[model samples]
Target chain A: MKLIIFPPIPSILVSLFVFLALRHFLELRERAPRLNWLLKYLWVLALPLLLVVRITGSRWDTGVFWQIDAVYVVLMVALAGVVLIRLRALQPARTLLVALAPFALYALAKVPDVFLDNLMVFSFGNPADIYWLFSIAWLVGGTLVAYKQQTLLQQQRLEHELEARIKARNQELEQLVEERTASLVRQAGELRETLEELRVTQNQLVQSEKMASLGELTAGIAHEIQNPLNFVTNFADVSTELLGELREEQQRGQEADPELEAELLTDLEQNLTKITHHGHRAASIVRGMLEHSRASTGERLPTDLNQLADEYLRLAYHGLRAKNKSFNATLDTDLAPDLPLVEAVGPDVGRVLLNLFTNAFYAVQQRREQQPGPDYTPTVRVRTRLLPGGSVQISVRDNGTGIPEAVRQKIFQPFFTTKPTGQGTGLGLSLSYDIITKGHNGTLSFVTEEGQGTEFIIELPLSARNSPAPTPGGPAVNPAPQTERSSG
Target chain B: MNILVVDDELDVRALFEQRFRREIRGGQLRFAFAHSGEEALDYLHEHASEVVLILSDINMPGMSGLELLGHIRQEYAAPPPPAPPQVMMLTAYGDDDSRRQALELGASDFLTKPVDFVALKQKLLQLAAHDDAPPL
Candidate 1:
């Protein structure tokens, strides 16, 4: 048989193409999952078949070809079948094992041919074909291994970068949440302050309404009392003249001197005295009621605070007694001797004192009610003292059942009253507070214990009487009195 | 002399009438009563030239006595017509504001309620004396 020759250059080219095809199949499988099975099958079987066809071209009739060619065909066919099975199962290890088996067999089959040829040629076999086959197999196997190593390295690098980006995003989200939470907390604090301010404003408004109603009621009562007082004064005047006439008749002895003249004179004197006394008392009562009912009237003036307190205290006590005849409480005043004259509206200041006196009276009465005995006489002490820095401190103290702690804090609040509904407008203390504090540029505060008693303290700056006119939206300052002292 | 007493309370008007009974019957003064500011104004309108004096309460529902006085002042701004009544304000509230307002509104004088008859008589006698005097 003619010597068969296989072109070495074409075989090398086929092996090179097989390597490229395997690379393309791997890229397709990674990038596109839908085409992965098809690409893997082509990589495992088709490329190898093409390699064989190229290596065996025009060399089929050689005697040695029949022997090695059949073995090559069987091994190639077995590789194809294993690769096809692996593709169906999609197993990476199985595919690699099947691919490596045929490559190993092909390399080993060329060993015998190399040994025999070397022995015949130069007392040593020519091993060129075996060497070529073994080198080709090694190239294919090494290329596959290198490709796998490169893919694993690339996957590890991508995972590390992705993990870093995720951590950064989570940190940014946490910071945003913190900032939003802080803003919400700030807004809540502002809302709470606003609510407290609104509550104070509402209290002021209710107190003003109560003052208006009380003014109306006092005015009405004063009108009703005026006529009786006038009658008392008139009758007393008439009786005095009649008594004078009777004494003149007795001196002349014009009538029967049955001692009727003396008796008539004495009776007239007593009746006239009683009538005059009661008439003046009623007149004072009306005046006090009138002052209490009146609203702020004129500009502020420099006032003798001690005298003002005394007059209002008298009126307040009488007014309380008039309402409840059994309500008898002694009031003691401890006015400062050298208290500097403070400028304030006399009528308005009088009203504030009246409120305090009335409240003290009520507190003492309440205490008396709780303790049942003849000796349970209630007493209210009103004292004024000159403080350093031209300030005056006035306090009203009562030995009454003190306010409970739970309600003590709320006493100055408008509409918060311990008295029964009809008896109190509930604005008295709040109005008094406003008058002393905001209206007079002073301070009003109180202290109380459960069983001991209660005391309301007011401090006024002497300069407050001459305070400048209040601007709109600013707190109201009391108007100063306009007149100088005339007579007591 | 005809006197008009204006107040909202019926009892207050009755008390005034009772107190002035002697003067009213003797024809030294004739009594007329109006229960509200509006009623007083209407009476004044009809008897403008006849009323000798007016005693009015300052606080009344609807139109106050002060408002009535204001109307009277406006109507009699010039030399008052014949027998134009002298107006006096009577109020339970003796505040300076009311007093100033009353005086400003041309009220001749003011007296607080629970009135003293002696003081009232003295004021009436003084007003009568002033009325007897010729206008300067």
Candidate 2:
């Protein structure tokens, strides 16, 4: 190695830089990768170029150049063939043939060089030395390429294993999703079953409520009739006694003064008058109660809208006031004077108006609570007007908390109310709806704005059929709950 | 003997006044009226010694007839030298519950409305007669 002189250090550095730079360039464009033939063949050029630089510009002998040249040729041919074979671009035979081309050309040129060397004088080392150097270079470059290819195959296997794991995980995830979907479907079925059970229970509860209302009505009747009965029996007994006294006085007329006779007779007459008056009063009360209890006569009677409205408005207001001392609001009534009879069920129309007025009052009261001040001044206005189509329009408007948009659709639904627990039955509007539409052949509707106010409108045609209001044991028989709660 | 008629009904006052008119004018009986249990209790508080009997209706608006009975039994327990004032209860309901409660609260008699005025008059007359009898 010393005889071969110092191995050109700058050449080694420059050649390595060029080879690594080209390999990195190919790697960067790995997506569209081509064979890195330039990377392999670069060493072949570098060895020769170094030799030429030593030969032409330095004091190296011609024999040394020839030996180096032969070693470079054989090493280049062998490494090039290995690179071609590793690339998988050619069969072994073709790669061997292509790799031998440069050596073949060198051999042909050597023939002429040997003849020239015979004529002109130059010294070279033994042929074995060139073969020895060529063997060393070929061994090193071929092993490096083999090692690099082995590493690439190992990395490829690792990537294949990773891909298989990912595929398996994805399949498991899909199975889990399918199972979750099945479980969700099963739960939905169970929920539907529970819903059906709830509906049945709700129906039973409604039946119980009807029975309870009947009980309350009976108790109320018993209490109400007691007062009139007291008067009736007392007055009747008093009259009988008075008549007996008058009879005795008449028997004593022989001894009695005319004045005493007249006074006794007058007292008996007055007792009779009181008995008649109280008897009639008791009879009328019974009549009113009977009318209230019986289902409608199913006949259309001329209904008075204003009188009904006025009576119930005062009743509902006073009723609420009686129950709740804190409740107060301004009530305004606008009745069209001389309004014609609607020819509808009187109680049914009365019920619709009362429900509207109650809801209006409730709204204003709730609003007043949320924003309390002297200036708040909650007001409810009830208006009745006859439309051109022979329909009566009764509207109850209140300046109170309005119907919420989210709950508006459900307002008329049975058992739907925004009132706090126990304050409402949530059936008022629903029953009113049934009475106006199904019971009286009328329409019930409302308009509302959040936090501002609400207005309920009831429209009844003048010549509606005489359908009994639902209250005298219609669907309310099973209405199960809200009727006992309703004051109207 | 003084009698207290307690009821919220105005008609009750007129009816009682007329029914006992002969006795009242003859000085055989005196009648005092109170509109509610509270009024009855107030009148009795002032004139408890003079009143010989109290006939109270059960369901007055203020203090109930049963409540008045409790108050009278507790606060105005008449001494036994003379008979404790007899208390009769009247109720529109005439329920077993009201009857039991009134009796338990020391009501001497329980009557349901419309009460038999004849029976009531006879009972008062007997009480007057008992008062007239010689002391043991």
Candidate 3:
């Protein structure tokens, strides 16, 4: 059998390579759970095995005995058997122990050689060779352990940094969501406030419309009542004359005949009766005017606008005629069929119709005054129809001396009127505009020409739901020439 | 004396004619009628110096009593204007502003409708007395 000799250069290179590989292995073992088991067992058993192998290999002078070779082969076999068992079991700790066994035996065998060489003082072999091998093994093992500790510390630092970054990211996401939710809530609140304001504006418009209609009625009533009052004054004057004449006859120095006295009494009674009748008639006219002029107050209910117009027209016409029996004008009505019921304050709406009718009557009367000839008898027309977009429109047209263009625009302004100073309050159209536009979410307008006549149109929403609730600072019905009057 | 009753109501004029039957018979008073402010103005223009007093409603279509009063005042304020008749205003609304405006327009007095017959007669009597007196 030939023995292999180790060159000094190869031995040093092998030792350095082995030292580096072992250091790297120990570093990997500490960081990974897979290496934890290996670390425990390799440190315990593999160190001793490597030392034994080293000791035996270097002690060749003790004997070239076959037993030593046998022992070396047996130790190698045992080491290889441990590796096979660890591989088969797939245990990290066992594999590390087996892997270290050969190195440990080599190291141990080197130790024994050193001890033997030193014990024989006269021996020719150098003990320094054995010392060098043992020193190299210790250096390699110490470096591997030191590298393992450093790797473990670095891994812990990485884990802590990763955990902190994750926590910070989650906190930022939560803050962003909260900010977005708060903005949405604020926007929703603002929207609700705007809706509430719109409701308030709508209510104010309706109230103003009612007031305008009442004012118009007041003017009409004043015009209508003046006629009958004139008659009362004249009749009273005439009756006083008759009474004076009767008293003069009684004072005369003559035997007053019972029959003659009775006839005189009868005549006086008849004339007085006529005076009383006429006076009462005038009073009734004034009463009707007052009632019509009062503000409308009623509960909201579903009502047909067409029926309301018809009824009020008749009442207004009769009331006007009662005061001025000589005022002769024809009334015409054009009402649409099958209008849906409108939710409204019934009395309030009725008053509006009454005001419109009376104005129409006065307009015709004015026409008659302007042209006394029989060729032109005054005529008033009232019309109602369902307008587009679910609204009802009512118009009162008069064939009278039409409104002048210059003053037409100013007519709806409060305290603006063509009538004499003592005659008009000028609030009629202004109040009417407010009611229809603001109160009912409706519209009122008129068309006029200097000679043709005037037509007033009122548009009202058909249903309560279609009418928007009043809102504060929302668009309100404005009483001006644009809305109140038109020129054709 | 011939008198004209201006009013829009036929019944009112008829009542006046009925009450003054004795005056008509004795030739103490004669009556004519006009139904509107314009008519009354036209009648006054035609009858120049014949009317004793003008009683009018302040509220009337086309022209009101106050406007008529202004016209009357203007006519009388001029030179050689025919005997200025006494003017009175009657109205349903007796608001202070309206009454003040009427009186300022040279109306003799303002009365509300329905006027008291006795009071109106007394006013007419006083006006007639003044008419008989010489102008200041």
Docking class of 2: incorrect
Give per-residue CA lDDT, model 3, range B52-117, as digits (tens): 777786655345577667777877788876768777777766777778988888877788876666
Least well predicted 10-residue stretch by lDDT in candidate 3 chain A: A1-10
lDDT (10s digit) by residue, model 1, range A1-488: 32222332333334345434643634435544544464344335545544565576745444334444434444543543453444433333344455555555654564465335321222114455455455556646755764575467467758887888888888888898999889989999998898788778865664455465455335334433554465565556556555666767768766646575665566566556656665766675566556555556646678788877775665565455545433556567898889878877666667677777778877887887788664665778889999876788888887777777667657776667887877777677776776766667777777776656777777777866455443456543222212211111
Clashes of each: 15, 3, 56
Local accuracy of candidate 3 as per-residue lDDT tens digits, A417-467: 676775545555665666666667677788877666788898888776777
Off by over 4 Å in 3: A1-346, A350-457, A460-488, B4-15, B18-21, B33-36, B92-105, B109-112, B122-136
Alpha-carbon local distance difference test for all models = 0.63, 0.65, 0.61
Better of 1 and 3 by lDDT: 1
DockQ of 1: 0.04
Rank list by lDDT:
2, 1, 3
**Residue B45 error for model 3, in Å?**
1.5
Candidate 2 chain B lDDT trough over 10 residues, lowest sum: B76-85
Q: Per TM-score, what order, best first?
A: 3, 1, 2
lDDT of 1: 0.63
Q: Please give the distance, in angstroms, between residue A207's alpha carbon in candidate 1 and its true position after superposition.
A: 4.5
Please report the candidate that would top lDDT against the real structure. Answer: 2
| DockQ of each model vs. true complex | 0.04, 0.12, 0.19
Reference interface contacts recovered per candidate: 0.07, 0.26, 0.26
In candidate 2, position A11 carries an lDDT of 28
Per-residue lDDT of A473 in model 1: 68
